[model samples]
Target chain A: MHTLIVIDRPPYGSWSGRESLDMAFSLAAFDQPVSLLFVGEGVLWLSQRQDASAIAQKSVERNLKAAAIFGIEALMADQSACQRFGLGDGTLIDGVETVTDLRVTMRRYDHVVFPG
Target chain B: MHTLHIVSKSPGHPRFLECLSMVDTNDVVLLTGNGVVALADSSIEVPSPLYALEGDIQARALTPDSARCQVIGFDDMVALTIQSQRVISW
Candidate 1:
């Protein structure tokens, strides 16, 4: 099944963001089609150069990088959400797509999973 | 198109209403996470047929109104997800 994992929470505040990646990787491991979509405050998950060592946590920046290796190439961020956080394409990690109509884009997937 | 609305929030949470408002009679609603509390809290009503994750229900020791909503396992959840034309989670 094709699944779209939506992460709406920022990293470090909770384990939800990283946990969502674990689910995505699991789905990909089972050979299911999977993608990652970041909305609202979740856009922060794509921020470059995140270091979580200060908070005694692993950096989610690593998870974002590993997404492509998991065959989850469809990394997306909501256009409005990125703007809300003042994030531009240049500020985000490479290989992320910014979509304007999130509702329309979401229909492409058979299922959407929210780990938060 | 028929949509599957997945609500992960309990009643009184803002996402619960946002999820309810997005679904209509033709859609399906699955209550997961803290959302299973809605089964006991009768104040919330979903326009579409409602189901709660069996795992969550059992974990919370919640006895859902079986007549109003059904309890489904993870396999059934996967089936429902594929059966729906689209899905959105809140």
Candidate 2:
């Protein structure tokens, strides 16, 4: 079954950001067709200049790159959310698709997750 | 401190990938409901102890009623957030 993972929280506000990623990788390992959607404050986690590791947190940029190794091919960023936040290309990780339209993708998945 | 790390998705996100790099393996990965789906993957490299919340068949495999599970919902996640030194939701 197809699954869509929704990430809505910011980088370090809560564990949702990390948990959502865990779920995405887990599903991908099982060979599920997984799609990742980033919305709201969640978009901040994708920025390229993030260096939260100094705060003793993991490097989100490196983690995102790890997803590709697991066979996950559907990382997506919400277009409107990005524009509203004034965060763009540099914020998102590599190998992620930017989705300006959400309805079509949301409807395609059998299971949709709100990871916070 | 006994920290609770809630994982709702697999393959992980950039922030989480960054977050784990900061955390030690002692922290627990709380996989609730749809979150339990994250645990089925053999590809994820996490060796952290994983606990599933209620409402998932997988949770039952871990424990009935998820008694051992770190409650992620059924209340404000922030409540538990205060109990522990931190709460990281991905």
Candidate 1 DockQ category? medium
Interface RMSD (Å) of model 1?
2.2
Per-candidate RMSD vs. true structure?
Answer: 3.4, 15.2
Model 1, CA-based lDDT: 0.83
Stretches off by above 4 angstroms in model 1 are B39-45, B51-83, B86-90
Per-residue lDDT tens digits of candidate 1, residues A14-98?
Answer: 8777688889998888888999999888899888888888888887888678878878859999999898988885688888899
What is the TM-score of candidate 1? Answer: 0.78
Query: Model 1: how far is A26 from its true place, Å?
Result: 2.0
Best of the candidates, lDDT: 1
Encode model 2's per-residue lDDT on A9-79: one tens digit a residue: 77876786888889899989999877778877777777787777668888777788788788776778888
Report i-RMS for every model: 2.2, 12.2
Clashes of each: 0, 35
lDDT (tens digit, per residue) of candidate 2 on B1-90: 555555554445554454355355555566655456444445655534545555563454533333333444545454544555444555
